[model samples]
Structures are given as C-alpha cells and as structure tokens.
Target: MAVFGTNETKVMLPRNIADGMIKETRTLSTIAKLSAREPQRFGETEYITFNDFPKAEFVEEGAQKASTTGGFGSVKSKPHKAQVTMRFNEEVQWASEDYQLSILSQLGDAGQVALARALDLGAYHRINPLTGSVITGWDNYVTATTKSVEIATADADADLRAAVGLLLNQPTSWGVNGVAIDPKFAWSLSNLQTKNADGSPSGVQRYPNLGFGTDITSILGINAAQGNTVSGTPEAADTKVRAIVGDFQNGIRWGIQRELPVELIRFGDPDGQGDLKRNNQIALRLEVVYGWYVFADRFSKIVDAV
Candidate 1:
C-alpha cells in the first residue's frame, strides 16, 4: 500500500490581508518648530560645530583722538557630538503589508517624530538648564549666564509679567521678543486675574486671551509658545526651568547638516540565517549632523516658576 492516502485534508493558514489597524500616537515637536535651522558640513564620524562672536564694545570718540588698543572679541564654535538613532523591525513591516498599510511610510514618519523630539530636547537643555549645571551650546562660548525670577504661590501672573520685564531690561534694544512656557503653567496662566486695590479679585481678567482658545497670541507684546519640554520639578526645591523668554533669534542657534540623512536597505541580509534574513525583514537608519549655540546669555531669561 502507498504511504500517502489519495484523499487528504490540508490545514488552512490565515493570510495577513484581513488584520485591522490601530490609530497613530501623538508626538509633539514643539521646540523644533520654534528653532531656526542652519546647515553645516562634517564627516560621518566627526562632530558638527559653529561659532558666535559677541559685538565689540562701543566707546565715546575723543575729538578724533585714537582710542587705546581696544581688543577684539574671539569666540569659537561649539562641537555637537550627540546623535539619536531609530530602528524598525521587519516583522512590523510584514504585519503592515498584511494590513494593507505602507510600512516604509510609517517607519519614516516615526523616524522623523523621534528625531524632532530629540532635537527639541537638545535645544531646551542648551537654553534652560538647571542651576549650577553647565549648558551645552552656551557653556562652550559664554558662561551660560541664565537669569530667572521668583513667583508667588497664589499669584503667578505678576511674577510672569515681572519675568518678561526682566528679559526686556537687557541692553539689546531688541529686548525679549519670545517666550516658551510649560503647557501646565500656560493653562494656569490663562485664568490669571487682575487684583483690586485691596489685593482681592477685581472681577476683571488679566490675560483674558492667554488660554489655549484665545485670540491673544502673545503675552506682553512678545511671541509666546507652550512647550512641555520646559523642565521643572513641582515638589523639589531645585531650580526648575518652567518658562524661557528671550530674543531667540540672537540667543538660540540651530544648525542642520547638508541634508536629513535617511537610509533603507530592502535586502541588507545576504544569508538566509542571520537576524534580518531569518526574520524576512529590511533595514532602515537615520543619520543627522547638527549644532546649537546660545549667543547672548543676557538676551534670554529662564523662569523657575512652580
């Protein structure tokens, strides 16, 4: 008799074409949106860098009498060696194909989101770092001369205004033209009220248009934006950077490489037993070179408001 029967039942395997898809998650790139991008050139293994020179001092003319040897200011570019990476698994791509979705597009989107978030955080650290801590971009050139203002527990509105006032006091005529506030703090600020002569609520609103849905786009005639990355510990006595106000154009610097480098290898696996080969997946990587600099410390202010 033959080993195999003439009639046999075969097992039926389900195809991946019927799987449902879930909604995408939210990723905010707040600081990146506010920053300016300048391109720089560097080798793949080398760090990116840039320089910022402070303006030379001005002296009163002495009736055409030559001024003593006024020295020139020299500032060197700060090196940015920090890099962030992103990876996508092959299994996820297969599942995406089964679900009738473009895995490559999804991966690209996720990669951009990750890079944006990482860059935003990098900018924040350079701009509003904790007390006694050395800042990245500014520490290299200037001594990271960050200024701050204290806030009252019950009323932060006055403190906020005062903070803005302090920023405007800088010698630069531009003054403080921008501010980045914590989302939670901004929410509380939206409800701030003016006080009566007796320090009681005057039934009048201050910053009536400060909230999320208001028409008032700025606070104190300066551009204002809400960023969750603005760091601050609610219960700790340590210095928390809740808000940052400044002439961002002259205070903050963002540098981009020649291009946003993205690479994908559909058949990176040569053998059929390696991780990629066995998993039947492709490979993807993102590489970017950039640098950041804080030009004038006095041009910026960080608020430690709780």
Candidate 2:
C-alpha cells in the first residue's frame, strides 16, 4: 500500500500559495537514494545535450580530420535510454492537498494512459512494485489573469472562486464537489520540480496543464462597462458568463525519447517564461516537462492503465 494509507494523497497544489508553490518536498526512501534531498524529487537520470558534439580543431591544411565537422548552430540532442528513478512525498498521516496536486493527478493519469498504449518498446521495469511511482507524462496550469474593464484585481479572487464553484455545481456522475480524476488515463506519477529558465527549481509537478476554451476570454473573465438596464440586467453587469479557461492561454505536451521509467515530473516556470522541459532525452530528470498546443483538434489522446 502507499505510505499515505491506501487513499492518502500528496498535496498536489498548496492552497495558500497564491504567488507560487514549492519546487521540492520531502523525499521517501523506499524507492530512491537521496543525495541532497530536493524538496521536489526527480525520476530522470542522464540526458543528452548539444554540448555533446565532438571536439573540433583547426585542421592544418589536411591533418587527420578533427573529431567533428563543426556546424555553427546545428547541434541537437538525440534520444537515449537514461536511468529512471521514481519518487513520492507524503505525510505519515493522510489526505491533505494542494489544487496543483489535483491538477497533477489529472495530467499524470492522462500521460500514463497515452504512454502505456504507445510505449511499444516496453522500457519501464517497475522498480517499486508496491506503488508504481514510474510515470511518463503530466501537466501544470497557471491563471494569467487580467482585470476586466469593470472588475478589479481585488475582485479577481472572488470571481475565480465563484467560477470554480459554478463548474463544480455542474451535473456529473459523482457528487459535484467530489469530482474524481478521469479513470481512462494510464501510467502513474508522484510529484516533481519546476524551474526558472535559468533552472532554479520550483515546487510544481508537470501534468494536467489543460486548456479548455472555445472562444476569447479564456484567460480573462467577464469584462463590461457601466450601463443602464435594458433586459432586467444592472449596469456593469455583463451577461457573458464565460469564465476564463486558464489552460487555453498556455499549455504543453510530452513524449518519451528512448525507453526508461519516468521518475520525476515538475511543472512551473519561473521568470514568467513560455517554455518547459520535455524528455526528448535531455535534462537530468527522467520526466522533464515539454510543450505543445493541441486544443482538442482531434480526439483526446491519453493512456489508461486500468
């Protein structure tokens, strides 16, 4: 059973962190041997870099050709089978949470499903049988909010909460407040670190950073100017109830390079940049985050391990 009882969960997204979340957390020892104990752990091992290009030299006329033919900027990272490390974080107690955690669970499950069906090479070895901490893909989402013409930043929080409540109240199979992660996803995940473009890590897992919008205002909520009542509506009251779709503004996608168990997955990008890590066999972490922009252009893609 998981260290958090059978039903315990890692705090995916901390509730109090409005500015940001931790990049690392306490490491569990059953699956990994920690070196420095990163607050956010990693599952990835060695990664390839353009820096691996063969050493070059100025050939004197015609000496034995230097190690490589240098290309001014043609170096690229190639796929390789790197070591896979799995990890988990939890309290000895039980189910506590972060909204980010919920998001991670959703994306990680989706990644697991997509990877399982497509990983025909069979790279995962399941080092820890008790809990398959090995994972393949994941998500992260942040709301880039802007004040509406009539709405102030002060009101953003309440509006966001109201929108979330509305979504929660929508009809579904389970009770409105207790929506479960989609069951069709494959694979599994623990948490991972996020980082700045300079690579200073942050406490965000990489998975389920989804975008769900069919029109404008996906990231910003209702915006209206003061007005008079025409249809029983008050001034400054915009009838457009479309809540911002946080995922639609920025999102990502990932695919494995070679065969290996994915160990860690981080998600946030500090310095407010637009890129993320993906395991095309780069980076030290096994399951580095990556990017893509496919807004349901076709059928949804995922891996479900049930």
Candidate 3:
C-alpha cells in the first residue's frame, strides 16, 4: 500500500546474502576465476599494458648505455550495469519471518546465477545479457583475438593443446595459465578414449581421473572452470566457439563493485509488466556494476568448423 521510489527507500542486501552471491558468482563464472581482478571505482579505470618488452644489453664499463624503447598503451574499463529483478506474491510480506528469509535467500541465489552468466556472456561474447544483444564498441575474447584452433573430433586433446599453444606463441609470449570451457566441451574432454595398438577402443578412458561434475577445477594441468555461457548457442550453421584458453592473469582483467543495491517495488510498472499494486505482486531488484578489458591477444578460442 506504500510507494517507494527513492534511493533512500532501497535496501542494501544483507552482508551475508551479498557475500554468498559473490561466492556463487565466482564459482560459476569461468571468466571470473580465470581473469585478473583489479579494484575499480564508479568511473572508468585505466590499466597500462606494454606492447614490447625492454631489451637488455651488455655495455662496456663507462660506455654510454643506449635507451631501448618499450612500447606501451593504456586500456580503460567502462563499467557496465547489470541487474536481476524478480516478482513475488505480495502475501509473502506477511508470511512467517523464516519464510521471508528463505525467499530472500532464494532470490540471492538467483541473482548470483544471473550475474555469473552475464559476466561470461559480456566478457567472452560481448553480449549484453539484459537485452540479449551484442554490446557496441566492446570486443570480447572470441571477437578480439585472431588466434583460434579448430576442434578436432579425432583428437580433442590435441585441439586443446593447440589452443594453448596459440597463446604461448604470441609475440609477447602469453603463457597459458587458465582454461574456460563449456560444459559440452568439457564432456568431450572427459570422454577422450585410449586406443589399443590397432586403434580399437581400449575400454579405458584416457583421463580416468577427470570428472564431469558441476565444478571442473582442472584440465591438462591448467586450472579450469565450466559454464554454458562460455559457448553461447550459435545461430544455425555457424562455427560454434567451444572454449577459451589464455594467460588470464596478464591478458584480461575484471572488476565488480563492492556495493549491491536491492530495491523493493510496491507500486507502478517498473518492468512494464502491469502495475504491481493491481496485480498483488511485489518486485525485488538487485543491481551491480561490472567492468572488464582484454588487454592482449593472449587468448585463443577453440571452435568447431562450420
């Protein structure tokens, strides 16, 4: 029966709930686990990246030492706002205290999942999750890098190895440190089979230790994480990008604001989905700021041939 439309009316999510959401997001988002994180403020944050390493030279004693030029550039991170809003029955407001807490917890979980997916989609695919459209002027990993390895059905292991090779072979020697893969691609890795002398199925899995659980911590000795958002469903007949391997520590960086605002809407159609008061429904919205930048061509994508 009350309308609240001001920032003062907004509720800061409980610290525990916010912490839980951040933990779940990091666990679920491969990009978050693989990339470096830098502190970011409300405005743009700039990072310096060297294009060329300084050369070391041997100089005779007292001889003039020449200065070697090392090219460098700056990359700015532009914060992108993300939000998750859910509508619930207004009756829950009067429900038992435990029930209300349960509802809030569930909402937090949903927000984390959404944020995880958004991080992958935006950083890997340059997609804006809210609109399901490519973000203009933003180049994601798959789009920004020319290095790629075609997935080989006969040797999935070789494909990944080659992908890693691409990163290591960069001009600046970008060593592969982390791999982010789609669940489907992760399955393919897990299903790699050993062959007999005659090339028959040896009935032994090549990587018997590999597990296809919700969390895939490692692949081929490199840290890894799994999420469907790694390889979004491509349009029909398009080359599907399956995985990304790179020097995430030095090649890419991301940051999330510490503050997460949660607002309860009691009236009006915030989502253009009819008035909440008339529908006897209340909406909970959680919003956060996220930013990222790919500073080098140190990533290689594994893609299926069209």
Choose the strongest candidate by lDDT: 3
The true-versus-predicted C-alpha distance at residue 15 of model 1, in Å, is: 33
Best-performing candidate as measured by TM-score:
3
Q: lDDT tens digits, residues 1-306, model 2?
A: 222234322222222321121111111110011112112112232222242335657778767874574333321222223232233232212335343245344444434433322221111111112133322332111111221212223323344444344433434211111111111110111122356798764656432222211111111232211111101112222223222211221111222333222233333332233223332211112232211222111111111112
lDDT comparison, 1 vs 3, better candidate: 3
The sequence of per-residue lDDT tens digits that candidate 3 reaches over residues 1-306 is 222223445766778999999888887778878876668887677888777887888899999998887888888877878888899998877777677777778889999989888877877787777666776777544446888888766677899999888767656686888888877788887887899999898878788767653467888899887777776543112227778888878777788954887888888998988999999998998888987777547788898877
At residue 235, what lDDT does model 3 achieve? Answer: 16
Backbone clash count for every predicted candidate, in the order shown: 2, 44, 0
Query: What is the TM-score of each predicted model, taking all chains together?
Result: 0.62, 0.16, 0.89
| Alpha carbon lDDT of each predicted model | 0.49, 0.25, 0.78
Instruction: Mark the 10 consecutive residues where model 3 has the least summed lDDT.
Output: 1-10
Q: List the residue pairs that clash in candidate 1.
A: 38-256, 50-77
Model 1 C-alpha lDDT versus the unseen true structure:
0.49
lDDT of 1 by residue, 59-107 (tens): 5776444444434543433445433233445455435333413443444
